[model samples]
Each structure stands twice: as structure tokens, then as C-alpha cells.
Target: MTTDLVAAVDIGGTKVAGALVDGTGDLLHRVQGPTRARESAENVLRAVTDVVTQLTEHELWHRVVAVGIGSAGPVDARNGTVSPVNIPAWREFPLVEGVRKTTGALPINLVGDGAAIAAGEHWTGAARGRSNALCMVVSTGVGGGLIVDGRLRPGPTGNAGHIGHISVDFNGDLCPCGGRGCVERIASGTNIARYALAAGWRPAEPDGDVTAAGVAAAAAAGDPIALAAYDRSARALAAGIAATATLVEIETVVVGGGVSQAGEVLFGPLRRALGEFATLPFVRNLEVAPAQLGTDAGLVGAAAACWSDPDTFLIRGEAGN
Candidate 1:
């Protein structure tokens, strides 16, 4: 009746979540702490270590086997480093070693936050049992992971799923990656609101509702300006999805993130546009659905990854210590 365990860590711009994950991918002994973005990279790593320490010290944590970490991009999971564009402290930070040190030489698995989301879906969520699918996030920013032939493609530096960075329009807006018109810049929540603001929408109330969610609500309520904003964003996203389908022939697209809260308002038109633009007939059925795991997807995916490699699982020493 003993249970299997794994320590899963999710690092984001605002917070770091760590928990003991069972073989079933459910979290146990979960805890949280601030990411302290302005702090030094060492301080952030130290915070991650503190959380892992708590998990390892817990009385019932013995069954935990290894550690799997998901962090903000652009992560170099292969080399165990992170270079998140938003968090300046993490440039070339050695996060893997930090985890390993905290776990007493436990094997630590790492991947980009987007890839972790994909792994979570593939393991037990919406993308389960699918041969080709994408786990995408359209939150403050847009990002995603690719699964090809039912396998996670951790390309080159384990950052292969920079789908958001791909150009949706060459003559479109400039991107943080020094590119022009990336799908993320146009479709992300940030961009959605930015476009809405430029379209001459002013809030009547003092607080002001100038976010993508509010815009989506307005669009649903028949606001022409808001609808136009959503329309523009949805079209760009649809094009990106179609382009992805053209290459991978994906069967489903699982989208999550803050902006995805718009649901049908965002997806309906996106589906229509994808249908019209997707050239390959095989990709016509690329079903778009909401992500099931929400923010916990990263932790769940980390635990799920444990099932993929048993050798490393056995080497993890934290569960024993």
C-alpha cells in the first residue's frame, strides 16, 4: 500500500510552487513563496531550495523519487539553465544544480513552462492518448509546447516550443525577441488590450477596464470596438495554429492561460478562421479546447515526466533522505 512520490517545482514570474507529487500526478504537501524577481538569481534559487527542503523534511515524503522543475522561458533544460526574458535575475542561472543540491543529488528533470503544460496534458489531461497535440498558453503572454508522434520534442535546448515567437505577420508589431509581428505580441492578453486601447475605447468608470478579459466581455456584449480587438487577436492566433498544424498535423490544440478565460468569445472566431485558412485537409480537425490543469499543470507535468524515465527516478535520493 506504499505510494510513489516525486517533488515538482513550478517557477513563475510572481511565485514559485513546490509540492510532493504522487505517482498518480496528484500534488501532496504543496507550498508556495514569492519569486522575488528583483532579487539576485542566487536568492531565487535559494527560495526554490527552501521549498524543496520543506517537502523533503516532511514525515510522509519518503516515497518521493525525483525532482522535476518547470520554469519561465527561455529555459535551457538540457543544460539545466534558465534565461527567462521577464526575470532578469535568471539569465544563465544553474537551476538544475540548485535543485539537485537541495534534494541531495536527486535526479532533477526540467523543461520550459510551456513544455511542462504539454506534458501535463499528455500525461493525464485533455491531450491524453493523442498522437499530436499542442499545450498552449494565451495569458499575459502566449506560449506553447509541441508533441510529435506522442513524444515531447525538447529540441536543442528544451525550448523548441517557442510557438508564440513565430511571426504571424512580418509587417506586424515588433516583438521582444527582436522579431516583427509574432503571434504572441498580437494574441497575448497584453497585446489584446493594447490593441483595444489604440482603437479609442475609454472606460466610463474610474478603475478602468482595459484588459483582454474585459475586452472579450465587451465583444460578447456586442461592443464593436472590443469585437474588433478580439477579432484581430483571434485571427492572428488562428493563423498561428494553422501554420503549426501545417507542420505537425496536430489533432488537437489545448489552450490555457489568463486570456483563454474568454472561452467561446475567443475560440469561436478562431475556429472559423482556422477552418478557412488551414490548407492541409488533415489538419482541418484540429480541435481547440481549454487546458484542464490550470496553473498546476506545470507541477503535474513534472510528475508525469517521472513515468517516462525510470532510471533517473531510481537515482533520486531525496525520497530516501
Candidate 2:
């Protein structure tokens, strides 16, 4: 039995992960390295290069037909570049060129991490069988992607489905993205914890570990402020999701990330808020579901990008590259 595989790279603020993914959505070999995002841009690229080197050295490397890279946005797939928000060192980084130089210029599919997640979910998770859907990650930051007409629409720049920066509250607090009332400004895990702390939601433990998880613990213990913080985040997320559904006609929204793991504490309010915002006739049937894939969604989605549309695969030396 011949097993076809693809080399997958997932680049984030904290770490750079790589894997050999088989056609069945299985990761055969994996390696990772710290991103050291605060370091120089060359240092960040070194970490990514290390991941590619490890993957190519595997004996099964020959079975890998292509490479797929999912990086923090905003990514320009058309120009084969990326400028991740968290990694300040990488401003319009030539990611595709770096990967090509390391891997002998194999075909590469570059996409924003959000688009990768949507492709993964569409292939094997919550959005499976749904032609039009939205997939999101609400962790240290919020990000999302879209599926349209039975295909992942990464858009020209590969950052099309970025829902986090969308202004849900025009007159609200200023966001890091220079927008007021962005969904991420209120709904991200970091913001959730910040809101809880600013509102006097102290931790039960005396260590002062005021994390989103800590806030979740407080909410679980019936802390009113913590619960209200989550409610506020949920409301903002609902507005963003509803706006996406209203504009693009998505039928489902699959939410993943650390915040979503809070389960009902977040979803209960998010669903209720969505009911209030997604009131349009076309968007009335939009449904929300939990992402079935965990952290591995990025890896699976990277490979799925290649499998999802082989014809449009971006070769290393192609015009875009």
C-alpha cells in the first residue's frame, strides 16, 4: 500500500511545528521548536527552517509530494509572504522563499492559520459536509476562516476570513489593530482575563494567576464578575459571527481554541447573543458548533489545503512565488 503524504508547517507566535501528514488525516511524524518571536526576523525564520529540515530528513520524506504552510496572518499567498501580528519580527517576511530554499522548491500551499483551520474542519471536523461554514480559533487571539460553495475561500491575500479585527463596537475600546471594538479586543482569551481582572474578579487561589482559565474557574464557582466577563466576550463574538453569516451566508460556525473549551460558560451566552444578532432571513438558520479538531487542526488543515484543491496548488517557483 502506497501512502501519499504532505509536509505541513504550522507557524505561530510561540512555536513552529512541522509534520508529515498522510492522506487519511494522520500525522506520521512530527517535530517542533520554539519560535522566539521576540528575536530578530532572521531568528524566527531559523526556527521555521529547523522544522522543515527535521521533516525532510525523515525516511518517509520521499513520500511527501508537496508542502503546506499555515502561518499567523496577515498572509499574502498571492505574493507568497506573511506578516503575523504576534511575531513583530516578521513584517512581510518572505516565508515561501525561505521554505523553498530549504525544501528544494517543492510545491507549497501558503495560507493564513484561520484558513487552514477552516479547511481542516471542512475535511474532517465540525464543518464536514457543510458547503458554507465559518471556522474560528479564540485563543490568545481570535481568528477565523470561511468555506464557500463547497470550497475553502482563502481570498487573494490568504487572510480573507479574519473576523477578529472586525469592528463589532465602533465606539468601543481601541484595539491593538487600530480598530475600535474589534471582536478580539473583547472576545480573545487575553481580553477575557483582562476584563475579569479589571472588573475585580479575583482568583480563588492566592497566587494571582489571573489567566482566562483562572477566570473560567471563578465562573465555574459562580463568580458573578467572571461569568459576566465571559458573557461580554460571548456577546462580542456573537456579533462578529452574525456579521460574517449575514455578509457571506455561512450556514454553520465551528468555534475552537482555549476559550471554546470553557464549554457552556462561553457557548451558552454566545448562542443566545447570536440569536439576537443573526436575525436576518438568510442568516436565521446559522448554527454554532464546537470544533472537533484540537490543536492539531492547523496541521491537518495544512495538508487538507493541498488535498482540497490540488490543481490550484502553488508551486515554489510559480509566478506567485
Q: How high a TM-score does candidate 2 get?
A: 0.95
Off by over 4 Å in 2: 310-321
For model 1, the superposed segments whose C-alpha errors exceed 4 Å read 310-321
Task: List model 2 lDDT by residue over 1-321, tens digit each.
Answer: 126788999988888999999988889999999999999999999999999999999999987778889899889997889888888888888999988999884678899999999999998999999999999999988898999998999888888789999999999999876789999999999999999888888887789669898888788878999999999999999999999998999999999988999999999999999989999899987789999989889999988887665453434225245
Q: lDDT of candidate 2 vs native?
A: 0.89
Identify the leading candidate in terms of lDDT: 2
In model 1, the clashing pairs are 5-64
Per-residue alpha-carbon lDDT of model 1 for 79-132, expressed as tens digits?
Answer: 889988667888888889778877875677888888888888888788988889
lDDT of each: 0.81, 0.89
TM-score per prediction, in order, is 0.91, 0.95
Model 1 residue 108 CA deviation (Å) reads: 0.5
Cα miss at 218, model 2 (Å)? 1.1
